[model samples]
Target: MKKVEVIQDFPEVELVGRKLGPFKEGEEVEMRPWEASVLEERDFVRPVRDFSLTGVRKALIREEKSSRLEELPSSFYRTVSREVRRLREGGEVEKAEELEEAIESLVDFRIQKLARMIISSVDLGDIPAEEQVLANFLSQPLTVWEGSIGRVFEKNIDKEVGVHAKKVRRNI
Candidate 1:
């Protein structure tokens, strides 16, 4: 769900077989994200605290300074993607490019951090609901890979130790 503030008056709209709002200017409402996105496309409303470059910068800096994953709004990535698309369509190419670079760097850093957490068997603290799904998905594959690799090493080490033990016994 997203909370949006209406910027223009809008009459009741029937969408997806449901009637939504006769919203007035200055009204704030909570709606399904899809509905809010539809209204947002038409400029009827904007997200209260829409994603901004300054916010992204702060998040990036915070993430860099921490071992734990930085908490972000649940719809953080979706909001950033939408904003970047809007910027490109509006001919704000330079701003869009800068935003894309910053977002990419942040995403890459978070991914690396998440992988480290998973490898270390550490608790995933303060992760957004949206990213929790990603962590869950990655956990299974990583566990499998680690088990497979550990078994291979275990077998080789066991064989080497056995051979060394037999050699020592013979010398004794």
Candidate 2:
């Protein structure tokens, strides 16, 4: 289950023998992913990323970055980024700041993980299944996913080819 904020009013919904809310716009609620998916498909709600743990969140980001073998859904990161900005502008400055920091940390962690994956995939001859996936992800031109973190990944990959790679490699 995860937290999601309603973006539109919805009548009460029953699921698993329990009644959920007649949710209003801007209302936050806990929901199972399957249930949330129904609302999300209609653009009625957005998932709230858990940003409570700096280290754990950063690690998760690293794992996600390294495991990608294909493109993500179009709205995946954009929705989270938009929600963070919304929270920041809606008077939740402290929480927004925390989420923003987590996002930055996640980006950094991802860069480091990609750098390591590049090195291992190129130099180690044969690597793990996940590393192969990372390698495949990197094989695509970053421009294929315009306006996304693919640009950051591309920049990091370029850097990893030189002295900066040495620095990023150490972190991984």
Candidate 3:
């Protein structure tokens, strides 16, 4: 579940056999991702992070540093960055800073999770299907793990090659 803010008043809605929100504008709510997406499509709600301009900036910076910027459609980040700058210029400094911190925390959490998955895959000599998908989506080359685990295993071929072979076999 993720946090989202109601952008407009909305009557009660049923979700997954449960009732959620007859929410008022500006009300913050915790909701499942699917629920959020439904509301977002109507422009009746937006993710909490969307309210923070500085957070968007920091997230973009982190994505660039990690070489994941290209993984996202350019228009998405560009739109966010434009809004962030507008908010800053409008003197919403405090709000922007707070949002920046939140975004940074979120990005750090993701990076840590990726690092853990990489290490675990190295130790186990096999990457989970979900982790492989995530790594690919992030444009994180498997070769990045080569140095750390290349020779750790007794196999003559490199670990990267072995992992690629496994991935191909699994796909087939």
Question: Could you estimate the TM-score for every candidate?
Answer: 0.62, 0.37, 0.34
Query: Which prediction has the highest TM-score against the true structure?
Result: 1
lDDT of 2 by residue, 21-46 (tens): 79999999998888899889989898
In the range 8-53, model 3's lDDT, one tens digit per residue, is 9999988779898899999999988998998899899987764355
Candidate 3 backbone overlaps, count: 0
lDDT of 1 by residue, 49-134 (tens): 64667668778888899988877877787889999999999999999999988898898889899888888889988776667888
Q: Looking at model 1, which ten-residue stretch has the lowest summed lDDT? A: 163-172
How do these models rank on TM-score, best leading? Answer: 1, 2, 3
- Using lDDT as the measure, the top candidate is 1
Give the candidate order by descending lDDT. 1, 2, 3
lDDT of 1 at 59: 83
As for candidate 2, its clashing pairs are none
